[model samples]
Target: MSRYPVKSETCHEAVDLADTLLPGNAGVTRAVVLVTDTAQLDLWRALLTGEARTSAVPVVLRRHDRRSLRGWAQRAEVFTTDERLERLHALTGGWPLLVDRAHRLHVELGDPDEVLRRLADMLADRSAVRAFLEATGVYADPALAAGYRSVAAEFGGDQVDTEAVVTAIACEIGDEGEARWVFACLDALQVFDREEAQLRLEPLLQQCMALGV
Candidate 1:
């Protein structure tokens, strides 16, 4: 199990401290710190590759991709067949949280297709998933917002946020082409949707981006 740092401390700082202590005269060869957030991943990319000069190469960055997701599925023990395994991987696009949710849903529903359907339903109703979509900051763009106005209209002026409304439309629509288009919009907005299904958002970010918060 991964041990989290104190409330006031940052994960990067903890990683740096560990890296510093690992090298000296000890038998330990190297240490790796994994960061999952796209924003934080971008920050680390800039920090590690920035123009600043450093004599020693300290940190190495690696991303979790489709291959990694396959390994993760094996470890999760949720996918019994190759087809289901591939479907799960495709549906999640290697997003860890989505994969975890898919695994949980499979455990509960016991039907692979049903898991996907349930995930689609959860994208609209789950607060945590809604928050994840909001973190992508797609709603801030006027053009994108205008483009999704029809989908937003489906909500009938409900108090629900734009992210949730658009996602609900995507899940509820039957036309594959239109669903694909909606998924593309979500992708452009940086909204989190796994294979055009199962949108996710971080709650803290959702709160941060809330109106008048």
Candidate 2:
């Protein structure tokens, strides 16, 4: 119901134009919506909370229907009137307009610890664990590697073998260069102090040699 300074066609076209102009991963920091009807209001709400992910953007909606808009204002990071569209454009540029409407409602996603805990929980599945390790490598986090080592040591055996895990950690930490050095040293040694450790490191040595490391 709020009167927009620009024509309705212009405003609608702006949405499409903004999308094409925005860069990949360039999130919307702020957004202004010029609403003309109740349907548009509902559409905006859906966009802000729908299936599409948009936790990184912020939005401001300007409308003549203040009563309805105010009802859900708290759900959004910012809210305003159609008269302020130019100001919103100035502050956010075309990029903010391209933001996922739902994502623009919140400014901060959540706490880092909460995010990490969720990640850990998500990775608990054996398939997810394998996928994560393959994607991120063994030493993605040094603390995580140390924790794995400690846990493997305490458990012992194949269930949580220290040697295999350590080799994986070394592979991750040393990369090709370090893996090659460790592998070479292990191959050269005729007698190993720890048979288990030697057995574990031998495979890594073989892998390095095979890779021509």
Candidate 3:
């Protein structure tokens, strides 16, 4: 079954592109396209893909695993032992940015544990990562501030409202149909499960989103 409600029948790219360029609602597709600009995303949503688009805004962070982490570690100058490297990869869920940051921290601090500790500490602080998480939470610019506030509120609350946080973030995206792709693509946050329709924020992301809420 499709992740969202839409018919999936592949059509000629030229035909689709031409229809997307023209004014009228001549053609649309359930196929996804990643666009950089929010304005362009809106335009695409209006003209070409409609609800099927997964905007590349806030750029998706691809996850890393042991093999990929080893490759990344090799590229970095840090003195990364296999044990330490594995620990770092597991801790960050192989999110490339975080992995890079952790690598830098390991190089600077000289220990994976130290790097993890500092990262944990950063998440503990209210202001440090809040902005970053909030910025990532947005699917649309108009709802940016509101999305941040919504996520921040959840952070302040006693319990971690996974559903609420995810739902609020989805609300920021104008189109409901495209929310799943957005959520699934959040490899950085590692919170949303596209298949299960679930949201379980990782520690770093939980703290960040909470602060953002």
Point to the candidate with the largest TM-score.
3
- Segments of candidate 1 deviating more than 4 angstroms: 1-46, 52-67, 124-129, 134-213
Following a full C-alpha superposition, what root-mean-square deviation does model 2 have from the true structure? 24.2
List TM-scores for all candidates, in order: 0.41, 0.18, 0.47
Question: Local error of candidate 1 at 99, Å?
Answer: 0.2
* Candidate 2 residue-wise lDDT, 112-154, digit = tens: 2333344335334555445433332223334333433432343
Candidate 2 Cα deviation (angstroms), residue 202: 19
- Whose lDDT is higher: candidate 2's or candidate 3's? 3
Candidate 3 lDDT at 186 equals 42
Clashes of each: 6, 6, 8
Pairs that collide, model 1: 131-201, 132-200, 132-201, 132-202, 133-200, 133-201
lDDT of each: 0.49, 0.35, 0.50
Look at candidate 1 and tell me the lDDT of residue 191.
35
Displacement of residue 148 (Cα, Å) in model 2 is 12
Better of 1 and 3 by TM-score: 3
